[model samples]
Target: MSDEKESVVGASLISEDRNGVRTLTLHRPQRKNAIDRALWVALRDALDAAGHDPAVRVLVITGAGGAFCSGADIAEPDPTHPVDKMRRLTDVALLLHELPIPTIAKVNGVAVGAGWNLALGCDLVVATPESRFSQIFARRGLSVDLGGSWLLPKLVGLQQAKRLALLTEMIDAEQARALNLVTWVVPESEVDEFVLELAARLVAGPPVALAQTKALLNEGADRTLRDALASEARAQAVNFATADAAEAFAAFAEKRDPEFTGRWSVSGRAVPL
Candidate 1:
C-alpha cells in the first residue's frame, strides 16, 4: 500500500499505512498517550479494520511524542458505568489478540498498567533502553485488566507474575527483556528504524502461513501434544494448498527469493487470512 495517514476519534488516535504495515499510534501525547474513552473506541475500530484488511500484513502499535501508553485515562471523569467502560478495553484487547496478522509493540517510553498488557498482547515487543514498564494496577488500587491477568503469568511464570503485579515496581528495558517480556531492546535512536525493518521482513513473509503459525503457537499452550501435532498437520495442509508454498519450492530450486502472494492454488484467490 502507498503511504497513507488518517486521524480517528478527534485525532486521539492516528492510523498510518506504509507498504503492507499499518501502524496505530496512541496520539494523546499531552496525557502521555493515556487511553481515554474516545481513544479506546478509536483503537478498537482501528484494530478491527486492520484485522480485516487484506493489504495489512503487519500491525505496529506505538505512542506519539515520547511515552507509550500510561494505561486508561482514569483521571478523566466519565459518568459511564465502570463495567461498560471496561468493556471498551476488553474489546481492544480481544481484537488485538485475535488479529490474524503479525503484531509488534514499539515501546518508546513508559508502558504501565493496561498499557504494559497492551504490549504483552502483541506477537513481539521492541522497546528502547530508556523505556520503563510496570503493572501499576495494584498501586492504583485496581487489579490487572486488559488481559494482564492472563498474559503476565504466561510470559513470566506465576510467581514472577505475582511479584510484578503485587509490587508494581517499575522495571527498565533490560530487566523486562530478561523476563522475556520484550523481544528486543534497541537504542532510542534506532528503535523506530529497527521496528520498521522488522515489520518489512514480516510483510515479505507468506501471509497465510504466518497467520496459521501464529494461531498454532497461541493455541498450542492449551492443547495436548497430540492435539498440537494434529493442528500442525492441518496447518501444513492448508499451507500446501496455497500458491505461496509452491512458489517457495520453485524459488528455492531457482536460487531466488520467494514472492509470497498467499493465493489459493485452486481458486487463484487470496487466502481468507
Candidate 2:
C-alpha cells in the first residue's frame, strides 16, 4: 500500500489501495458527493485501472462526506453533447460491472437517481442504517438512465422496480435491504470498519474462483437454464485448473487452513494476498 492517497481531479474523487483492496471515494462533500462530469470520468478511469491491476483483488466505492452521492450535479452545466454524455455514463457503468475483481458499494448516506444506479452496478452493496435511497429520475421529469432500467428489475423484481421508479419515493436502508436493493444495513459508525473486514475476507479467497463466480452470477439471469448450467461447468473447469484448487485439496487432506495466494497475471507461480 502507498503511504499517500491519490487524488483524482483535485479531490473530486480519491483513490487508495491497501492490502489488495482499492477504494475509490466520491469526494464532493459540499455537493453531497454528486457526480459531475469530471468525477464520472475519474471514476471510469479508476475502475479501468483497477480491472487491469493484478494486485487489486477487490474494489470498494464510497463517498467521503457524511453523505453518499445525492445524484448527478444538475447545477453544473455539461459542455459535452447530451449523446456523448450518455455514452460516457454507459461506458462507466459497464466498466464497473465487467471488472474482473469483486466490487462493493458502501453507501453511507443518501444515494438517489443515478447515484443509486451506480451503487447497483456493484456486486454487493452495504448501506448504513440512516442511508436513504431513491430512483428520483421521475421526480426530475427525466426517465431512468445509467442502466437503472435493467439493474433495478433484476434487483427488486419488476413490480417493485416500477413502484420505486414511478413513485420515486425515498426508502430507508432497512427498507432497501428488505427490497433486496441493499445487501446489508449496518450502523453508520461501523460502516467503514465493516466494509474493510468484508474486503479482507474477499481478498483472502481464491481470486480465480471468485472472479469466475462473479461472472457466472452476473450472466446467469440473462441465460436459459441449460446455458447457465453449461457456463457453470465451464467456470468450474477453469477453477479446477488453477493452483489454488490443488492447494485446497492438499490442505483438506492435511487438516489445515489453506492459504490462498490470489494468482493473477504472474506466470508459473502464486503470490500472497
Candidate 3:
C-alpha cells in the first residue's frame, strides 16, 4: 500500500500506513499520551479496523512526542460509571491480543500502569534505552487493569509480577529487557528505522502461516503436549492448503524469494494478506 496518514478522533490519535504496516500513535503528548475516554474509544476503533483490514500485515503502537502512555486519564472527570469506563480498556486489550497480524510496541518513553500492559499485549516490544516502565496502579490506589494481572505473571513469573505491581518501581529499558518484557532496547535515534525494518520483515512473511504460528504459541501455554501437537498438525494441514505454502517450495527449489499471497490453493480465495 502507498504511504498514507490521517489524524482521527479529534486528533487524539494518528493513524499512518506505509507499505503493509499500520502505525497507531497516541497523540496526547501534553498529557504524556494518557488515554482519556475519547482516546480510549479511538484506540479501540483503530485496533478493530486494523484487525479486519487485509492490507495491514503488521501493526505498530507508539506515542507522539516523548511518552508512550501514562495509563488512563484519572485526572479527567467523566460522568460515565466506573464499570463502563473500564470496559473501554477491556475492548482495546482484547482486540489487541486477538489481532491476527504481528504487533510491535515502539516504546519511546515512559509506559506506566495500563500503558505498560498495553505494550505487553503486543507480540513484540522495541524500546529506547531511555524508556521507563512501571505498573503504577498500586501506587495510584488502583489494581492492575488491561490484562496486566494475566500478562505480567506469564512474562516475569508470579514473584516478579507481584513485586513490580506492588512496589510500583519504575524500571529502565535494560531492566525490562532482562525480565523479557522488552524484545529489544534500541537507541532513540534508530528505533523508528529499526521498527520499520522489523515490520517490513513481518510483512514479507506468509501471513496465514505466521498467524497460525502466533495463535499456536499463544494458546500452547494452556494446552497439554498432546493437544498442542494435535493443534500444530491441524495448523500445518491448513497451511498446506494455501497457495503460499506451495509457492514457498517452488521458490526454495528455484533459489528465489517466495511471494506470499495468502490464497487458498483450491478455491483461489484470499485471506487479506
Candidate 4:
C-alpha cells in the first residue's frame, strides 16, 4: 500500500508507482492521448528512471480516457529541423527498447503510427478487445518512424509487416493478437485490472532472471543460436550469484511461495552497464 502517484511532466503524463509496478499514463484525452515532443521526453526519462530504480520491477504504459495514443501530436509547431526531430524520436524508441525492467503496453483504444510502434516497443502488450491498431504511416504520406520498420517485420513477418505498413489497415485487438502484435486482448472494462494483475505476477518473479530473459528474447532474433546459448549461459551464471536464486530453492524445499526482494546487486552494488 505504499503506492504513490506523481506527475512527471505536466498533466499530459501521469506516473503511478504501486507495489513494484510503475504505470505511465498518457493523459491527453482531448487529443486521444496523442504524443507530443514533451510527452516523448517525459516517457523516455520516466523509462530511464524506472530502469535504474530498484523499487521498480515492471513498467506499464497506457492512455487515459479509454483511448491509447492516437499517434504523434501534429498540432504543435516544431522549431527543430526534421532530422533533429526524428533523431529525438529515435532516441526515445531505443531507450524504451533497451530498458532493463519489463515494460507492458495497456492499449485501451486506438494506437496508430508512432503510437503503434510505442506499444510494440514494450516487452508485452495487453489491449482491449476492440482496440484498433495500424501503422497508418503510408496513409499520411510518411514512411514508418519510431522503429516501426524494424519492430513490425520482426513481430508479424516481413510480408505481413509490409501489408500493415503499406495498406495501413486497422486491426482489432484480436487480430493484433493473432498477428503476434498483442499479448492479451481483454475487454475494455477489465484491461486495467488484468494489466495490474499481470504486472504483479511479473514483479513477483526474480528481477535479474526476468531482465536477462527479456534481453535474451530481444536479441535472440538477431543472434546466431550459438551466440544466444552463450548469452543464456552467462545470464544463468549471474542469476546463480543472486540471493533470490537461493531463496527460490529454499522456498521450493519448504513447499512455500518465494518472497522475491528483487535486490540483485553485484558486490552489494548495482550492476554496471
Candidate 5:
C-alpha cells in the first residue's frame, strides 16, 4: 500500500485532512470539480483506504472552492466513442455506495449530472444554504446516469424524483430539504463544523453498534417484510453479543456514562475490555 501521506499528495479527488474524516474533494474546482480519470482512480483509492481504516469514522465528500461537483468532463471524451462511458462513470457512484464507512456529501454549492448522483451515493447529504442542485444530464440531451434513476425515487419517491429528473431544473438547499434530498442545510461557514461534529460523535459512539446499525439499515432496505424482520433479528443476535451492548445497559443501570470497548473491525472478536 502507498504511504497515506504520499497518496494524499498525489490524489485529486480523495484527500485527508486533520480530522478523522476522509474528504473526497472533487478536484476540478475550475470546472466545479468535474470528474476525470485521475480523480476517479484517486477517489477509489481514498474511499478504499477509509473503508478499511479504523481511524476514519466518517467520510465527507465536498467540492474544493464552491460547487461540490459538476459531474463528468464531457469535453475529455470523444463523441465518436460513447460506448461504455456511462457505465465507467457510474462505477464511481457505485464505489461511493459500497464504502463500508459512514459517508456524507457536503454540498457547498451546486451538484450537477453525475455529481448529483455522487452526492446521492453517500449515506447522507448535508448541503449549505446557498447550494443548488440539478440532474442536468437531460438538459444536455442525455438521460440520467449513475444511481440517479434508482436513488432519486428511493430518496424522494417516484413523483418528486420524476419532476426533478424530467425537468432538469435547479433546486436550492431549502427546496432540497423540503423534498428530503438532504439531512441538513446550514450556512456555508457552518457546513464543515457541523459535519465534523457528526463525525466526532460517530467516532465516540460504540463502534460495534454503529457499524451494525449502518449495515442493518443498508441491507434491510431491500428485504421483504418477513425477510427484513429476520435480518433485524440476525443483527440483534450479533449486536447483543458485543461488549458494547453489555456495557451500555450496565451503564444505564448505574446511571453513569458508558465507556465502550469495541473495535470496528469486521472481525467478530471483541476488543479486550
Candidate 6:
C-alpha cells in the first residue's frame, strides 16, 4: 500500500475501497474494538464520506484485528454520558440503518452489546466461523439501549428477541446465521476473501437501481402493502431518469461489458438528516 493507503489503514475505524466496495472497519482490537466517543465520531465521518462518494458502491463494516466490536467501553461508567456523545451514538446507529447504499457487517469475531446491535443495523452481515454475539447489558445491570431492542424484533421475531435481549446469552456464528441475523458464515480465514467477492459483485451491478432498491425496502418495512407499492413506484420512477439505468439496459441489449458511471445522490436522509 502507498503512504496514503497505509495511513488510512491505521484508523481506529477505517473506510477503504476495492473494486468500488468501500469497507469501514473498527480498529480497537487490543480493547476488542470497544466503542468510545472518539471512535463513534470517526465512524460517522467515514460513513458520511462513503455515502456521498460516487465511486463507492457498497459498504462493509468489520473489525480490525481481533473483533467486530466488543460494544461500549465499560472501562468508563455510563455508556453514554454528558448528553452530547450519547445523542451522537444514537443518531449514528440509526443513520447506518437508513443508509441508501448497501451496508454490510462482516462479523469476523465477537460482537457483544452495542457491537451486536451495530451488526444488526447493517442490511446484511457475513460472519467468520469464530464469530459470536451477545447482548450482555442485562448482565451489566442495564437495559438494551442501542438499536438492539428495535432491530432485533424486526429480525428474529418478538420471542427470540426477548430471549437474546433479556437472557443475554452468547450465541455462536452458525446460530446467528440460522436466525437470519447474518447473511453468510465462512471459515475465519475466508471471511475477508468472501466479503470482498460479494462486494465486487455488487459494485459491478447497476448503482442507481441498487440504491433505489434499498430505499424501497427501507420504506416498505413500516408501510402498508398499498403504501409500499406507492413508495416503490415513486422510487422506481426516480431511477428511470438516472444515466446508470439506461446504460444497464443498453449493455444488456448489446451483450457486451458495460462501464458504469456511479453517479447517484447520497441524500442526507441516508445519514438521518
Q: What's the count of clashing pairs in each model shown?
A: 0, 0, 0, 0, 1, 1
In candidate 6, stretches whose alpha carbon ends up further than 4 angstroms from where it belongs are 1-6, 9-11, 77-82, 262-273
lDDT of 1 by residue, 88-167 (tens): 99999999999999999999999999999999999999999989999999888999999999998999999999999999
User: How accurate locally, in lDDT, is each candidate?
Assistant: 0.92, 0.88, 0.93, 0.87, 0.76, 0.79
Q: Give one digit per residue, the lDDT tens place, for model 4 in 1-273.
A: 667666665658899889889999999999999888888778777777887888888999989887899999877776878887887788889989988899999998899999999999998999887799999888878999999999999998999999999899999988899999999888878887899899999988998888888999999999999999999999987887787777787798899999877565445534323
Candidate 5 per-residue lDDT, tens place, 52-84, comes to: 877666788888878898887777764544555
Q: Indicate which candidate wins on lDDT.
A: 3
Candidate 2 accuracy as lDDT: 0.88
> Candidate 6: TM-score?
0.89
Q: Which stretch of 10 consecutive residues in model 1 shows the poorest summed lDDT?
A: 264-273
**For model 5, what is the alpha-carbon lDDT of residue 159?**
92
Query: How many steric clashes does model 1 contain?
Result: 0
Off by over 4 Å in 3: 267-273
Q: What is the per-residue lDDT of model 2 for residues 1-273, given as tens digits with 9 covering 90 to 100?
A: 533355564458888888889989899999999999989888888888899988889999999777789988888998899898898789889999999899999998899999999999999999998899999998888899889999999988999999999999999998999989999998888888999999999988899999999999999989999999999989877776677877887798899988787543324544332
| Candidate 6 structure quality by residue, lDDT tens digits, 129-234 | 7899999999988778668888888889999999998999999998998888988998988878888788777777777778888888777778899999888878
lDDT of candidate 3 over 74-182, digit per residue (tens): 9999999989998999999999999999999999999999999999999999999989999999888999999999999999999999999999999999999999999
- Ordered by lDDT, highest first, the candidates read 3, 1, 2, 4, 6, 5
lDDT of 6 at 9: 36
